[model samples]
Target: MTSLPKTMHAVAATGSVPLDDERALLDVELPLPELRPRDVLVEVAAVSVNPVDVKTRGRRAADAPPFVLGYDAAGTVVAVGSEVSLFAPGDEVFHAGVITRQGTNAEFHAVDERLVGRKPSTLSMAEAAAMPLTTITAWESLFDRFGLRADSTGTLLALAGAGGVGSILTQLARQLTGVTVITTASRPETQDWSRRMGAHHVVDHHGDLAASVLELAPGGVDRVFTPSTTGRVPLFAEIVRPFGSIVAIDEDPDMDLRVLKGKSIAWLWESMFTRGVYETPDMVGQHDLLNAAADLFDDGTLVTTLTHEISGLDAAGLREAHAIVASGRSIGKVVVAR
Candidate 1:
C-alpha cells in the first residue's frame, strides 16, 4: 500500500462569497478522506476548473466551511474500500466526482468507483484531468438528453462552442454522430478552435445567432446545446426545428421555457452530477460512459482540450483558473497540476 499522509493541502472557497474576491478561496489543510464501501482513494495529480465550481462557490452560504470546489480530476489510486470492485490501489483513474461530496481540489480525494474510470493511457494526468466533467456533460447532453444515435443525420447548433463543454460537445457530435455541427464562436482564435474540434460551420454568438444558424442549416437545426444559461432561449427557439431537442447544463432561473411550446421543442437540462447526487439506480452508468470516452481518446476519435495549465495546487492558482473560467474567454479547459 502507498503510504498516506494524515493531512493534505487543498484549495477551498468559503460559501456565498463573490468568486472574484481573492479571499474567497484559501489554501488549507484537510485530513485525508475516509472512504465509503464503494469508494476508491485517489492521490490527485491534476484538477480542472469548470463553471460549476464558480457557481457552487458563489451559492454556498457565507458561514459555511471553506468548500472545496472542483469536479474534474485525474490521479492514481492509493487505496480502495473493501467493496470497490472496479479499481484497486495503483490504478490510474479519472472522474467527475459526486456534487454532494467534497470535490477534488485536494491532494487526495475519495470518489465512488461507479463514478470513476481508468485514465486514457495516451494522455498525461493534466491532460486527462481536463476531460471528466466536460466530457461527461457533453456525452450526456448529446446522446442521453437528445436521444441522438450515432447514425442520426441532422444538424446540431452548439452555442458558446469555445467553452469547455461546448468544445467537447462539438467534437462528439461531429465524430460520433452523422450530424452537421454548427458552433457559435465570437473570436478569431475560438472560431479556429471550434473548426479544429470538427465543427462543420462556425458562427458568431455575438451577432444574430438565429440568422447565422439559418444560413447554415437553411431551415433550422435538429438539435441545440448551450452550456451556459445565457438568455438565448428565444434565440434557440427561433433556430431549432419543430420537435427538436435543446439541452443545457446551466441553471436558467429567468428562462421562459414556455416559448418552445409552439414548436413542441423538447427542452432538457443536464447536470453531470445528477446520477451521483441522487444515488440513482444506474449510477454505474457514469463508469460505463467514462470508459467509453477513454476508448474514444485512445483511438484518436477524441482529443484533450486542455489549453492552459497552472503548476501548483494552491489557492492563488485556483483563483487564477476560476477567473479565466468566469471571464468566458477561455478557449478550452484550464487545469492545475501538482
Candidate 2:
C-alpha cells in the first residue's frame, strides 16, 4: 500500500456556532479518511462550488464540527480500499460525490469508486472539475427523467440557459439528442453563450417565457429542463406541450404542481445524488454517464463550461468562490484549483 498523508488542510465551515460575520469558510486540518470497501482516496487537484454547497453550509446544525464543502472534483487516486477493483492507485478520476458524506474541498478526499469516472484526457483538472455535478444532473434530466432519445426530433426549452447546469443541459440536448434546443437568457452575453453552446434559439426569460417559446414551437415543447429558480411552474405549464415532461433540480416548496393536470404533463424532479445518497443498485450509472461525457468532451462533441476560476485551496479563496455563486450572477462555473 502507498503511504498516505496523516493530515490534510481543507476549507471547512467553522463549527456549528452561529455568527454574524461575512466569513463562513475556515482553514482547518483534518485526518485523512479511512477507506471503505469500495472507496478510493484521491489527491484532489481541483474543486468547484455550486448552490448546494452554499445551501448546505447555511443549514449546518449548531454544535456541529467543521464541515468540508465541495462536490465536483478532479484528482488522482493514491490508494484504494481492499475490495475496490475499478481503479488503480495512479488513475486520474473525477466525480460529484454523495452529499451525505464529507465533501471534496480538501487536499485529499475519499469517494466511492462507483461514483467516479476516468478523467477526460483532453481536459485539465480544473476543466474536468467543472463538469461532473452539472453534467450528471443534465444527463439524468434528459435521458432518465424525460426519456429523450438520441434520434427523436422535437423542441426542448431550457430555462436560464447560461447558468451552470443550464449551460451543459443546452449542449447535451443539442449535441446528443435530435431536439431543437430553445433556451432562455436575460443578458446579451448569456444569450451569446447559449447560442454558442448550440441552442437553436435564445429567448429572454425576463420577457414572456411562454410567448417566446410558443413563437418557435407553436404548440409547445417536448421537454423542459430548469436548473435555476423554480417559481415558473405556471409558465412551464402554459408552454409545455400536452404530455410533455418538465424536470427540475431546485426546490419549489410553494409551486402549485396542479397546473400540469390539464395537459397531463409530467412534472418530475431530478436529484443527481439520489443514486449515491440512497446507495441504489444502479449507482454505477453515474460512472457510466461520466465516462460517456468524457468521450464527448475528448471528441470535441461537448464543451467544458468552466467560465471562472480562482487560485488556492484555502478558506479565503473558498469564501470568494462561494460569494460568486451566491451572487446568482455567475455564468457557467466557478472553480478553485490548487
Candidate 3:
C-alpha cells in the first residue's frame, strides 16, 4: 500500500459565528481521520452543502475546537480498516457521514463501510456528492416511514419540493409508486424545477397553502412530507387524510401533536443519521438504498439535483456553497468540487 499523509487540508467552522463573519469558516490542517474496524478512509473529491451544515456550524459551541461541517461526499477509497468487507482501496464511493463522527469536509474522510455505496457510473463526483444525504432522507421517508411501494396509490404533498430532499422525494414517489405528487413552490423557477423533478402538481406555498392543495387534491393528500415542521403541523393536519401520515425532516420539539388528534394523523420524523449514530441493526440499509439510487441514476430513472457548483474544495468555495444553501432560495443541492 502507498504511504498516506499524516495530516490533510480541511475547512472548519471556527466557532458558532454567523455566516457573514469572516471567521465563520477557515482553512485548517487536520490529522488524517482515524479509522474504526469497519471504516474506510476516502480521499474526498467533492462535497455538497446541506441545511445541517449550516445548523451545525451556527450551533457549535464557541469554546469548542474548530469543527468540520460537511456530510455528503463522493470520493475514492484509499484505505480500509481490518473489518471492512464492502470496499477496498481505489473503489470510488459516496456516502453521508454520520453526525456523531468527524465530518467529510476534509481532504480525507473516515466512514463506516456499511454507510457507503459505490458511486454511480453515470455521475460525476460533484453530481454524486449532491445526493447521499438527501437521497437517504427521501428514501426512508417514502419507503420506511410511509411504507410506500411500487403498487402504492395515493396523493403525496411534498412541501418545499425544489429543495434537496424534496427534489429527490418528488422523483422517487412519482417514478417508483403510483402516487400523484403535489409539490409546493412559490416561485416560477422553482415550480418549473419541481415539474422537472416529476411533481404532478405545483402549488404556491406563499399563498393559501391548504386551499391550493385542496384544489389539486380535493380529498386531502394521502401523505404529507415536510422539510420544516414548525408552524406547519396544523396546516398538515388540515390537508392530510385521516389515518394518513406526515413525515418531517426538521426538529420541532414544541410542536403540538393534538392538532392532528381529530383526524388521527400519524406524525413521524426522518433523520438519515439515525441508524449510523445509534449503530442500529439496519445501518446497512443506507448502503443498500444508496446503491439502489445509484442504479436508478445509471439507468436514467433519476437525475442529479445539483443546480449550483463551486470549482474547488477550499474554504472560499465551501463558504460560497454554504451561502447558497443558506439563502433559502436555492432550488436544489449546491456542491463544491476539487
Instruction: State TM-scores per candidate.
Output: 0.97, 0.96, 0.98
Q: Put down candidate 3 lDDT per residue, 3-73, tens digits, no spaces.
A: 99999999989878778787999999988999999999999999999999998898888888888889999
CA lDDT scores, all candidates in order: 0.90, 0.89, 0.93
Per-candidate count of clashing residue pairs (backbone under 3 Å): 1, 0, 0
Model 3 scores what on Cα lDDT?
Answer: 0.93
Please give the lDDT score for candidate 2: 0.89
lDDT of 3 at 160: 95
Q: Which 10 successive residues of model 1 have the least lDDT summed?
A: 14-23
lDDT of 1 at 76: 96
Where does candidate 1 stray beyond 4 Å? 18-22
Over the stretch 246-332, how does candidate 2's per-residue lDDT look in tens digits?
A: 888887778888989999998889999999999999999999999999999999999999999899988878888888987878889
State in Å the error of residue 245, model 2: 0.7
- Choose 1 or 3, whichever is better by TM-score: 3
After aligning candidate 1 to the native by TM-score, how far in Å is the CA of 39 from where it should be? 0.3
